[model samples]
Target chain A: MEEIQFWIGIVATMAFAVTGVLAIADRGVDIFGVLVLGLITAIGGGTIRDIILEIPPFWSENQIYVWLALAASVATFFAESFFTQPQIYRWMLYIDGFGAALFAIQGATKAWMMGFGLPVGPVILGVITAIGGGLIRDVLAGRKTLIMSHELYAIPVTLGCSVYVLILNFTPQYAIEGSAFCMLGIFAIRAAAIHWDLHVPKMFITKTR
Target chain B: MEEIQFWIGIVATMAFAVTGVLAIADRGVDIFGVLVLGLITAIGGGTIRDIILEIPPFWSENQIYVWLALAASVATFFAESFFTQPQIYRWMLYIDGFGAALFAIQGATKAWMMGFGLPVGPVILGVITAIGGGLIRDVLAGRKTLIMSHELYAIPVTLGCSVYVLILNFTPQYAIEGSAFCMLGIFAIRAAAIHWDLHVPKMFITKTR
Candidate 1:
């Protein structure tokens, strides 16, 4: 399970790096700038997660993550035009969903493994950690961040995390499997939402005006 | 001196938040989204600073900082349209200069007081902290991050921090005063750069290709 989690994180890093590179393809940013964005998008969320939990930043601890992000970044930068096609956007959305689900579950599980109590802080942090990198990427690329969108982005991660927490309370032995299931559930929902442009109802929208 | 730093931070926060809101003026984002961007622009640098230093996160200790960011965000959201007229972008550049100078000094000084060593690490962090928020803001807005432009942005902060560090080394008695001078220097240079479209020589540009 631990090995699965590690591989999942690596895959998430690759997806994020590629997404970052693709974002800047239209902007004609210098190569250095493009690579920076890609690497930042890849490691940013995990870095924040580790920092908040007072652990050594994950990228610093295992050099593989950094190298992987760099490799993904370089590959994406060179191949960006191919990935930016409208048809590929559909695939990108699914990949994003997969990455989000994997990160959300892993983040929550890590927090729990660190001896954080259930039902509150760790769960919130998990959702935050899962989305943090994407938020940063959107901000850097000059687009609307996930939190501000009407889309079902954060909702899936939140639901997955909550379900995982519930499962932990009921069956400790099956919690890992439960987490993976919940993660897949969130990913499927997100994929569906993207497929149909689904959003939470307007009534749930917090209006300041 | 501490009072000056606090007031400067407040002013910078307001300017950054306003700028963030203005950046999103025509993007069709909701009030919450605008607010999130504003708050992120205002406090994002300092948060990065705290994280790098391994300190208990600042906002968690005193929620006032969070409230201040929120207030600035709200104010920016409502007032942004008024300040984003055609000529406004020019004025914004100078106000942004002010923010850069203030944040750079405050960040460097805080790192020094926190016992981080002299010329290299803290200085780098100071510049990073100073420009970090704006960089993130530009990226998220789908524009080129200002720092990536061949402008004199990071240079001013670097020089200012060097001046401060020099003062701390030779004239410890006047360290605080020297830091103030450093901020003034950064402000002056930043203003000039905006006014004149100044940039460091091409030789300084790193070759990534």
Candidate 2:
């Protein structure tokens, strides 16, 4: 389980780096700025999660994460045309969904291990972990926050986290399976939302231009 | 020394809380959002600093910080028109400068005590602590980050932190005096910038729309 999660984190780091590059696609941020943005977006969520959990920042313990994100960001910068393609943007959306799902589960697992218990804290942590990086990227880019947008971004992650908490609370035996089930469910929901042009319902949205 | 620092922190909390309300002013965010933003803007910086230093969050030790911020935010909400005055915005800017100065010093003190050494890590931590909350507040509110603008914000904090670190390294006996001196210097620089419309100069600026 530990080994699998480690690899998931590695992949998530790079996926997030690419998304960071995409976030600043046309604003004329220089190369140095692009690299900094990449590193920040990639490691930001995990760093925040670790800090909240009172653990050493994950990148500080292992430099590989930093190097990988830097390298991925540089690669994206060089391959600007590939990223600009419409199909590639759609592809990144799926990769983003995958990373968000995995991150939410990882955050919940850590919070649970640390005895945060059910429902509120762990679920919120999960959602924060999942969306925190993207939020920072958009914020730094001066774009609207994901929560403020009409997109179905936070909802899937929230539902998946709640389901995981339910599993941990009621049926401890299926907890391992529950992790996998939740990750896939979150991803599927996100993919469906993107495919269907779905949005959060009107009641939840604030009226903003 | 610790006693004085604690009071500075309390004042900073209320100051940042008011700035947060001003950030969302005229945006039509409801009462709950205002309260939450206030609490977040108040504690977010110190919380980040503590987490990075691997210490328990400051608010976790004392709930008074939380209550004070909430109360200040509620007061601001009730007195919305008073806050809308041009002079009130200017006053908040000075309060922001004062709070930023103190928080930067506090962050540097913590990092130095933890043996982060000269000129690099501690300085970065200090700046992060001073600006982290405003960054979040502005980002969530979709405003440009302080660092991105030409405002002389981080520069003063950075110079003050450098002075603090230098005092710590060279003349350890005057460390407390150095703290006061640096805080005042930072606030003075920021105030001067606000009063004179000072900027970071065109050479250092990136061409962004």
Candidate 3:
């Protein structure tokens, strides 16, 4: 399970890094800029979480994630021109959703291990950690983030966190099992919503303004 | 002195916000994007600091800073083209230097008050707080920050932090007075470096193979 979590983290990092690289395909940014975006997409969340938790930044502690981001960025930089299709945005969304889910679970688990002691703060911080990388990617790419979208984007992670926290409290022996289930649940929900364009109802669409 | 600090903070916020707006001009970002960048540049450092200290975020308690950043961003957005001269960069450097110095002093003082008697951590965090916003701005803008430049940018703040910490230990009563002097010292050094294009000696310049 620990090995699975570690591999999932690496995959998530690479996915987000590729998303960042794809976002700036035509921006004429140099290699340095591309790497910066990729690194931000990969490590920005964990860095924020570690700093907020008053720990040494995660990337500085383990250089593997940073190297993975760099390698993925270099690969994407060369492969960007091959993405001739106009569905680039869709690809980005797919990759981003995958990364966010993996990160949300990993982050929550780490926060729990750190003795955050509550469902509320850990859940909130987990969501922040999950979305933070992509948020930074969007900010740097000069695009709107998924958070600002009309879709029920942040909901799945919130639900996953609630369930995980509840199970952790109620069944300590199955905490890891519950967390795994929650992680997959979130990934499925988020990916399906993105794929189907599923959105929460608009409170303003029915209004005659 | 307190009044001066207050005005300095306000002006610093305005300066940082304007810098963000200026960075956004080339990208043709909307009102929301511009405002976000401005607010990030204005309060991003302090946010990081508070989080690192495990304290509630400062801007949450006082919404005035948010309003100020919003107002400045809006004003800069509308009046952007008018300030697109090359000299704007020069002005930004000076304003940023002032802001960095003031924040460095304030952050160091706060850390001292929080009883982190060791000079190393507080002083380093002081410099981090001072330069963090600008670093974030550069990262979001896809531009290299002044820190990566050959100039003596962050070094001045480091020096200022050292002096402030020294004063805190040696002459506790004069700590406040010493902080003011250090602030001016940093501002003067940074302003001179910017004006004169002065930089720290590059010992590694010859090692570029």
Candidate 4:
């Protein structure tokens, strides 16, 4: 399971970097901008989580992630045609979803253990951990993030994180098992959403009057 | 000077919040989203800085800034026309510029004192402190931020911050006077950009060949 998690993380980082490269591919952003966006997307979420918890940025602890993102971005820059493949794009989504789920759970667990903002804070931090990097990426590239697309992007992660937090609150010893369970569950829901084109029902969505 | 700093911080918070509210005003985003953006823009930069420095967020130290941002966002939500007025918009630019300059100086000084990444890290942090929140705000709202607009937005803050850091490196005693000088310098450049439509020269622009 640990090895699996590591591979998922690697896939997530490269996937995110590729998407980041693609996000600004046509924007005429220079090479520097492309790399900056890629690195930000790959590590931005965990960075926010660590910062919110008053810890050194996760990347600073182990610079491997930074180097990987840079490598992926540079590769994407040179081989845009290869990365733009439809098969690679689809596989990357599942990889991205898996990473987001684990990231959300990890973030929630950290916040809960740290005892920061209790009750609602851990869940928020978890969601931020899952989606924050993508949000930063989209914003920098002026693209519409899945978060703002009124889709199922944020919901599954939020729900999964909430359940994970609740499990920890009630049964702390179940953290490991709960994390695995929630990770799969979130990924399943995300995959379903993508396959079925699911969205938040009208009642749950806030409409501007 | 202390009292002046206090007032400037307050104005800065309010100014950022108002702009936040305005950024998504026409996007059909709900009131909650507006307030969230407002609060994020008001404190996001310092939060990033603190996180990078491995400290509690500055807003977490003093909740007043959060309250001020909330108030400004609420006020803007109700009085959209008032905020959207041309005169108010014009005045807000200068106020925002002033706030950004001060924020950059403070950020640079903090990083320098803490001895983070030396020689260059503080300048980056200072620029991030000044422009980070606005970048988040624009990204959230899917608007073209001043940073990406090619108008003289980040350059002044970066240059001013570099100067301030240099002063701290050599003449630490001149910190106060140097800060004041840089503040005016940044604001002056920003004002000139606004008035005369200054831009980064074409030679500096990256072309996608």
Task: Report iRMS values in order.
Answer: 5.6, 4.7, 9.6, 4.2
RMSD of 1: 7.7
Against the hidden reference, what TM-scores do the models get? 0.61, 0.61, 0.57, 0.62
- Arrange candidates by lDDT, highest first: which order? 2, 4, 3, 1
Model 3, B1-209: lDDT tens per residue? Answer: 78878888888878878876676456445454565568777877887777767775566556567678879887887776556666876787689789889988888887778876476767977887787876776666555676776777789999999988999888998976898899999999999998988898887345557
Interface RMSD of 4: 4.2
User: Where does candidate 1 chain A have its weakest 10-residue lDDT segment?
Assistant: A200-209
Once superposed on the true structure, which residue ranges of model 4 sit more than 4 Å away at CA?
Answer: A1-47, A54-113, A117-126, A133-143, A150-209, B1-3, B195-198, B201-209
Among residues 3 or more apart in sequence or in different chains, the pairs in candidate 4 whose N, CA or C atoms overlap within 3 Å are: none
Tens-place lDDT digits, model 4, residues A1-209: 77887777777787777776876787787789889999998899988888788678888978888999999899888888887788776676667777788788878878888876665567868888888887888776778765456667677888898798888889888889998899889999988877787876654333454
User: Candidates ranked by DockQ, best first?
Assistant: 2, 4, 1, 3
Q: What digit string (tens of lDDT, one per residue) describes model 2 on residues A104-209? A: 9989988888887455778888887888877777778776678788788789999999999999889989999999999999999999999998998898767779
Give the worst 10-residue stretch by lDDT in candidate 3 chain B.
B24-33
Give the TM-score, chain B only, in order for the candidates.
0.85, 0.92, 0.89, 0.94
TM-score of 1: 0.61
User: Is candidate 2 or 4 superior in DockQ?
Assistant: 2
Q: Please tell me the interface RMSD, in Å, for model 2.
A: 4.7
CAPRI verdict (incorrect, acceptable, medium, high) for model 2: incorrect
DockQ of 3: 0.06
Q: Which candidate tops TM-score?
A: 4
What stretches of model 3 exceed 4 Å from their correct place? A1-131, A135-209, B27-31, B86-89, B204-206
Candidate 3, position B125, lDDT: 72
Specify the poorest-scoring 10-residue window by lDDT in model 2 chain B. B200-209
- Residues A1-209 of candidate 3: C-alpha lDDT, one tens digit per residue: 67877887787788888877776667788899899998897889878877766688888878999999999898888888654354865766776786787788778877778766354446746776886776777876776664434455567877788788788778989987887799888878888897888875543111111
DockQ of each: 0.12, 0.18, 0.06, 0.17
